[model samples]
Target: MKSFVFRQFEIRQSADVFRVGTDGVLLGSLADIRNARKVLEVGTGTGLISLMLAQRNPKAEFLGLDINQEAVELTRLNFESSPFHSRLKNIHQDFKTFDTQDKFDAIVTNPPYFEASGSEKDKIARQTVELNFRELISKSSELLSEQGVFSLIIPAESGNDFMKMAQENHLFLIRQIHIKGIEGSKNKRLILEFSLTEKALEESEFIIEKSPRQYSDPYLELTKEFHVFKNRS
Candidate 1:
């Protein structure tokens, strides 16, 4: 597995553990963490999202939870090796069974959106075999503070269903970012944020590429602080 090297930290990957990808990076970079002091990451794959959040908000402390033991260990290693080591922590625990009286200022996750697929490694990280959308919404509603926000990156097709479930849990949609793989392409992903308080929804679109293999200006600018792209514009 190829490690994702950032300006301030590195994500060392293992073959069995889920690798750092664009989705995690997008959530880390785009998730609103400015007002959050205590953040909880539901699925800590390689610790990428929390690490990026920690870098973005120096005052924020992060706690990561993962059902997979190997992922938890890998996330711990990545967190310990980063500059924000003191502010980051990870545990091997399933979010479904996680019982915490402490409320998080921000609950973030790149949830398992894929349906159940028979596989041994990394299946739990990608599929909803253990945790589904309804479960995630219910637990997040219970764990988020009054002004706390629940944020996630998921497939475009799943957006409506997720929002519906969240609304049922009294989580209002606050922000939504539609992601297009190409400039003129249909949305491929959505970066969503929900809060307890009802507020005006903020909607926006982000394009990942201008053309094949070319990063869009907005995408490049959004990730400038973290990405160490060669010949970066």
Candidate 2:
């Protein structure tokens, strides 16, 4: 087991499951969760996002859903050992077939982005083998409450198509943040927030590093609470 220690909780990632990464941490730290009582994390690998959000929104209850049994069990353990264990739950079920009468105030995901090209496990983790963007958007729209918000981080190139799909499902873009590897790098990822109602989009850009291995000030500020060495000089 590989363990990652954050300021509030520790996450242990099993060798066979999806490991915690910057994308997950970014979505977890940046997603808006204010006044959200019921939150759901789709494809919650190792439960990292849920734990982070739980720390931010102390009153929210989190449900982590994953299709892989091993991933679900690993997430369960991670949640159980966290300080917010009482407010977190994990279920092993494919998002496409997951049936829930209860709706969510907020839903977040760091979904698969690439086409199939790697090993079986890697293909499932990276490719849309289990869940594609269209299905994810449609299903999430149905699961969201009237005032619900859906937050996600995806490849920057797929933004236009994703926004089209979201609009088809009656989900409108409310906020967008483009992520770059460094100050001069091209945008690589997009952090987006959508809602049921159409609103003027709030857009911004974030750079992870000012140079190789040098964390940008904005990145450090956003993740300062969770990263122990964010202030390294």
In order, what lDDT does every prediction score? 0.93, 0.92
Q: 1-233 in candidate 1: lDDT tens per residue?
A: 77889999999999988888899989999999999999999989899999999999999999999998988999988999999999998998999899888999999999999989777657888889989999999999999999998999999999999999999999999999999999899999999999999999999999999999999999889999999989845
Clashing pairs in 2: none
**Candidate 2 structure, TM-score to reference:** 0.97
Q: What does candidate 2's lDDT look like per residue over 10-42, in tens digits?
A: 988877888989999999999999979999999
Cα RMSD (angstroms) for every candidate in the order listed: 1.1, 1.2
lDDT of 2 at 4: 93
What candidate 2 gets wrong by more than 4 Å, as runs, is 230-233
User: Top model by TM-score, which number?
Assistant: 1
Global lDDT for candidate 2? 0.92
Q: Tell me the lDDT of model 2 at 175.
A: 97
Q: On a 0 to 1 TM-score scale, where does candidate 1 land against the true structure?
A: 0.97
